[model samples]
Target: MITPMAIERTFVRTRKLATLLAGATLAASTTLVAGAAPASAAGPCGSSYSRVGVYAISRGDGTRTGTLEVYYSSSARKNCALTYGYGAYANTRSWKRVTISRADGSQEDTDANYYTYYAGPVYVSAPGACIDVAGTVPDWVTRELNNVHCG
Candidate 1:
């Protein structure tokens, strides 16, 4: 028997369930959007530079701690490098280093220090030659790329 009170209770329950579902959906969507966002659009290298290479910096146990990124500016005929810390190392003051050099060793730039996030936008002019890129995080986890992005 569907009395007036019974019908009212059922409608209230249904409305509450729908509201709960809607809230859950909204929360999930917000999380997805936030997680999809990139680290930085232009990165630490600036908008004029385009990323040319990326190498992973890992711990002795093979856990990734950061990345060594290389960027190039064709108009400027220059290459740049940076070491970006992440995971357990992110936003914590630690030793970091980034270096970029011409393959001939004619030009080199390096930045090394205790940084919270990253080290270096070190630049080297390597227009017609290859470039060497390297970076280091804490505990001597260093990664390098040699003779890359030539001509």
Candidate 2:
């Protein structure tokens, strides 16, 4: 005793379930894609320095628009950092601050500007100590990340 109305309702429910499943799969895949990137993928200090850490800063729109990169030149026995902006902020006047601290209470801080795209391979004379980096991009669109250990 199946009615046409009953069949219609079943079909609608099946379609809704399928849609939900599809959305879930898409979201999961997006998460995987974002997480797949290695931290050092955007090294800015040339091939001589090995990228050790990266800190991302997001704007009010929740889009990542800037990055602070920490690099170590093993051959030179020094730690370095760089900052840059992306998207619409790129090539605009941007200000960034990077601080690298050593375990011995010594630190190097750089406040730099990008008239074009990026700033610094700012160096900190840290040797044989765990290093911490913190930075910010300050302007109409502001972002910051702190306490990143980049040994």
Candidate 3:
């Protein structure tokens, strides 16, 4: 006959195993979700642009819903911006927007519409001046950067 101490030890081991399994499952699911995006040959902005910045768009509860990405093309003296939906929002039609403006108030470009994946690739040729950028995703925070990326 098994003793009470033996049964208690077995129950403790079982509980530990269950906790480990739960942690491992959560990790694996997170990895899969993060890796699901298809690789792009020219990136989101294009072959000529290099990513310079990224800002997160989050819900009131701090759930990340999207990102605002900024890319720069030194050769063209231009900056491009895009708003990309994340996780459950990806590949779903939603209101998205991206805007870019020069600090001098000379040029402003905006792209806003219902998009499956992203908002834009809006560009502004700022050259040596600073630029402002903004992005929005439905039901998420609208993020903005002002007078940034000077040079």
Give the best candidate by lDDT: 3
Residues 1-151, model 1: lDDT tens digits: 8899999999999999999999999999999999875665565677679988888999779998889988888888888899988788888998889988998777889999999989999999888899888899875899988899997
Off by over 4 Å in 2: 1-43, 103-105, 140-151
Worst 10 residues of 2 by lDDT: 142-151
TM-score of each: 0.71, 0.56, 0.69
**Using TM-score as the measure, which candidate wins?**
1
Candidate number with the higher lDDT (2 or 3)? 3
The order by descending lDDT is 3, 1, 2
As a whole number from 0 to 100, the lDDT of residue 57 in candidate 1 is 96
Candidate 2 structure quality by residue, lDDT tens digits, 1-151: 9999999999999999999999999999999998877665645665568878777767777887677788888777888887777666566776755656674547766656654566676777666566666555655444433444434
**Residue 48's C-alpha lDDT in candidate 3?**
73
* lDDT of model 1 at position 29: 97
**What's the TM for model 3?**
0.69
lDDT (tens digit, per residue) of candidate 3 on 1-151: 9999999999999999999999999999999988876464476677778999999988878887889999998888899999998877778998888889998766999999999989998999998899999888874468888999998
Off by over 4 Å in 3: 1-40
Candidate-wise lDDT, in order = 0.87, 0.69, 0.88
- Which is superior by TM-score, 2 or 3? 3
**How much is the lDDT of residue 96 in candidate 3?**
89
